[model samples]
Target: MKPSPTFEERWKRLTSRARMSIPDDFPELPPAFHTRVLAHWQAQPVESWEDLLATLGGRAVWAVVAVCAIAAGFVFTDFHEARISRPELEHVITLEAWIP
Candidate 1:
């Protein structure tokens, strides 16, 4: 099996065989393509930061809503001063048993 020609070799052969005939009045590429490309790349981080801020802002609003809901639940609860019956302290906790 033969290996495929490298891009440089293929390009050379293709260009040599068929040269495109561009009109003399053909419009050239826009000036400073490099500068435009660089500017776009540099501006990406700022856009990303704005997106991050937007996403975090939405999450923060949800977080505040959840906290307010939880606070309301606690505030509406009937936390009575009910008497808690207890066993003798000696029977509840045995230091000698815990040490072993």
Candidate 2:
């Protein structure tokens, strides 16, 4: 196998391939190019939560919120029913009746 090149040899090989000189007489950009770029940047609409909701429409947002509230209501009612019908409470009541 061939040995790896030294650091100096590697650096020189890299630099020789990248050697480029800029010419003294580069042409200037047109004045309108700057103003056009600035105007394009300024004309861009900044988006926020309100803009996002507006794009989705008020009715769609309300529908999603209503669906979530319904799901939450179902979950809460089931949890409450489970808590009320616990077997441990019935067992405790039966034990108290036997003791008394």
Best by lDDT: 2
Candidate 2 error regions (>4 Å): 1-12, 19-28, 57-100
Span of 10 residues, lowest total lDDT, candidate 2? 17-26
Candidate 2: tens digits of C-alpha lDDT, residues 1-100? 9999999999999887677544467788899999998999889957788888888898898999999999999999987774655698898999999987
Report the lDDT tens digits of candidate 1 across residue range 1-100: 9999999999999887676654458666686987898898887755567788997999999999999999888766736445444655555467556856
**Prediction 1 global C-alpha lDDT:** 0.77
For TM-score, the strongest prediction is 2
Query: Which lDDT value does model 2 have at 65?
Result: 97
